[model samples]
Target: MKKVITLTLPGELIFTRLAAQTAASVAALVCGECHPKDNNCEFINAFELAVSEAFTNSALHACQDELPPVTLTFIAERHQLTVTVRDTNEPFGIETPQPDIESYPEGGYGLLIIRKVMDTVTYRRDGDANIISMSKKL
Candidate 1:
C-alpha cells in the first residue's frame, strides 16, 4: 500500500522544529511499514535531516519580509519515500558550489548535507513557486 502525507507550514525559522517533527513522524511511520522489525532505522534519520535542511533553507533564503507558506508532501511506497517542499518566494537557484569541508565554514552546508543523505535531490521553479524534491529508498 502507498500512503501520502502533506503539511503546510509558515515559512519562518520559528516553525523549523515543527517541520522537522512532522517529517520525522511521517518518516517513522513509513519506515515502520517498510521495515517491520528494525525500529532504529537509518532511513528515518536521513529523512528527518534532509527535510529539516530543506525546510530551513526555504525559511531563511526564500522569504522576503513577511514569511510565505511552505508546503511539504510525502509519498510513501513499499520501498521508497519521496518528499517535495514548495515555497512561494522568489526562486533562488539551488546551484550552490560544494562547500569545502576542510574550511568548516560557519554556514552553507544545508544543500550539501541534503544531497549527501537523500538518494535523489532536484529543484525547479513552477511559475512563482520554488519546489525542492528529494527521494530516498527505504
Candidate 2:
C-alpha cells in the first residue's frame, strides 16, 4: 500500500518556515520508504529547495490580492516527491530565460533553481486555482 501525508499551510509569510519543515518531513518519509538504505541527501535537499521556491513564488506572485487562501501539498512515494501548490491568483507563466546563460540577470533565478532541483515541473489550472507541480526522484 502507498502512504500519503498532507499538510495545509496558510497563505502567509509564516508558512515560509514550513518549507524547511516539509523538506525534513519528506526526507524522513522517503527514508522510511527506502528503509535499510542510506538517506538520499541530494534528493532531500533538492526537494526542500524546490518546495521553498514554489512556496515563495506563490507568496510573492499569487497571493498579491486579498484572495481566499493558498495551500501546498506533498505526496511522497518510494522514489519520488510530488508537490502541489494551489493558489487563487492570476495565472502567470514563467518567462523565457535569456539565450545567453551569462546574460541572465542575477535575479529571476527562482524557476531556474526549481527546474534544476526538480526532475519535472508542471503548471495547471484547476477551477480558480493555479496548481504548480514539482517532483524530484530519489
Candidate 3:
C-alpha cells in the first residue's frame, strides 16, 4: 500500500516553521502506517531534517512578490519515502557545494545538510514551477 499527503502554504519566511512541521508530522504518520512494528527514529529524523531544509529554502529563496504558494507532497511506501516541494518562484539553479564544516559558515548549509540526510536529492524547473525532490530508504 502507498500513502500520500499534500500541503500548501504561503511562500513566506514566517510560514517556514509551520510548513516544516506539517511535513514532519505527515511523514511520521506515513512512516508509522507503513511500518507499525518498528520505531524508525533515524529515518523519521532524516526525513524531517531534509523536508525542513527544502521548505525553508523554498520559503526564503523562492518568493518574489505577493508571497506565492508552496506545495509539498509526501509519498510513502513500505521501504521508501519521497518528498516533493514545488514553488512558483523563479527557477534557481541547484549547486551542491561542499562547505567546510570547520569554517562554520553562518548560512549556505541547508542544501548540504539536505543532501547528506536524504538518500537522493534532485532539483529541476518544470514550466513555471521550481521543484525539489528528495527521497529516503527505510
Candidate 4:
C-alpha cells in the first residue's frame, strides 16, 4: 500500500522552516510504517537532509522574486519513498561543480548533496514549472 501527503508552502521564511519540519515528520512516519524494528537511522537522516536542501533550493532559486507557492508531496510505498517538490517558476539550470570546487565549496552544494543522498534525482520541465523528483529505497 502507498501513503501520500501533500502540503502547500508559502514562499516565506516561516513556511520555509515548516517545509523542513514537514520532511522530518514524513521521515518519522516512513520509518515507523516501513521498518519499526529498525528506525533506518542513516536513511532517515539522509532523507531529512536532502529534502530540506531541495526545498530550500526551490524556495530560494526557483521561486526567486516571484514568491510562488511550492508544492511538496511525499509518497511512501512498500520499499520506496518518493518526494516530489514542484514550483511554478523558471527552471534554473544546474551543473555539477568541478571536482576541485566540489570539496571545499560553501555554496552550490545542495544539488551535489541531493545527488548523493537520493537514489534518483529526476528533473522535469512542465511549461513554466520545474518539478524535482527525489526517491530513496526504504
Candidate 5:
C-alpha cells in the first residue's frame, strides 16, 4: 500500500513545529512497527528531526526577502518513507559542509544532520521551485 500527505505552510520559523508533528505522525503510521525494539522512539524521532530541519531551512532562508509559502510532502511506501520539501528560493548548493565543531557553533548543521539520518537525499530545481527530497528505509 502507498500513502501520501501534503502541507503548504507559511514561511515562518514558528510553523516548523507543525511540519515536525505531521512528519512524526506519518512516520509512526507508516513504519512505527519497524522499531518495536527501540524504546526511545528512534524511528519517529528521525522523521521529526529531518522534517523540522528541512522546513526550518526554507522558512529561515528560502524567501531571501519575500515570504513565499513552503510545501512538504510525505510519501509512505511498503519499504520506505520519502519526505519532500519545496520552496521558491533560487537554486543553491545542497553539499553543505560540516560546521566547525570546535567553535561550538549554534547553527549550520541542518543539512548535515538530515543527511546523516535519512537514507537518501536529493535536490532539484523545477522552474522557480527548489525541491529537497529525503527518504529513509523502513
Candidate 6:
C-alpha cells in the first residue's frame, strides 16, 4: 500500500519551511521505525532540503502575476518516497549543467543540490503547470 499527502502553500519564500517540514514528516512516516526525532536516519534531511529548494525556486521564478500557489505531493510506497512540486511557471530545461566549482558561484546550485540529495530528479511541463518530481529509495 501507498500513502499520499498533498499540500498547497502560498507561493512565497517564507513558506518554504512549511513545505520542507511537511516533506520531512512524510519521510519519517515512510521510514517506519527510524524517526528523526529519535535518531538520524533515512533520507529525511535530503527530502527536506530538496523540497525546500524546489519550493524556493518555484516561489522565486514562478509567480508572474499575483502570488500563486505551489503544490507539493508526496507519494510513499513500500520502498520509495516521491515528491512532486507543482507550479504554474515557464518551462525550463531539467538537464542544466552543474555550476563551476572553482569560481565559487553564489547561487545556481538549487538543482545541483536537489539532484545530489534525491535518488532521482525530473522536471516536465504539464500543460500549464511545471512539475519537478524527486524520488528516493527507503
Model 4: residues >4 Å from true position, as ranges?
Answer: 33-40, 62-66, 98-103
Better of 1 and 4 by lDDT: 1
Clashes per model (N, Cα, C within 3 A): 0, 0, 0, 0, 0, 0
User: In TM-score terms, which candidate is top?
Assistant: 6
Q: On a 0 to 1 TM-score scale, where does candidate 2 land against the true structure?
A: 0.80
Tell me model 3's lDDT, rounded to 2 decimals. Answer: 0.79
Give the distance in Å from residue 127's predicted Cα in candidate 5 to where it truly belongs.
0.7
Task: Give per-model TM-scores.
Answer: 0.89, 0.80, 0.86, 0.83, 0.90, 0.93
Candidate 2 lDDT by residue in tens digits, 1-138:
445666766666678668656765666567554322234666666766777877777777645556346677777777777888888877878554734567756667788888887889998888877898887777
Evaluate candidate 2 by giving its C-alpha RMSD to the native, one decimal.
3.5
Off by over 4 Å in 6: none
Pairs in steric clash, model 5: none
CA error at residue 52 for candidate 1, angstroms: 1.0
Could you arrange the candidates by TM-score from highest to lowest?
A: 6, 5, 1, 3, 4, 2
Off by over 4 Å in 3: 33-40
- Model with the higher TM-score, candidate 2 or 4: 4
3 or 6: which has the higher TM-score? Answer: 6
Assess the local accuracy of residue 60 in candidate 5 as a C-alpha lDDT between 0 and 100. Answer: 80
Off by over 4 Å in 5: 34-39, 64-66
Which scores better on TM-score, 2 or 5?
5
Task: Kindly list the per-residue Cα lDDT of model 4 for residues 67-120, writing each as its tens digit.
Answer: 888899999987888888888876766566644674676777788888888899
Error of 2 at 67 (Å): 5.6
lDDT of 3 at 104: 84
Instruction: Indicate whether candidate 4 or candidate 5 has the larger TM-score.
Output: 5
Model 1, 37-126: lDDT tens digits are 344667877877888999998898754777888999999999988999999887777789998889988888888899998999999999
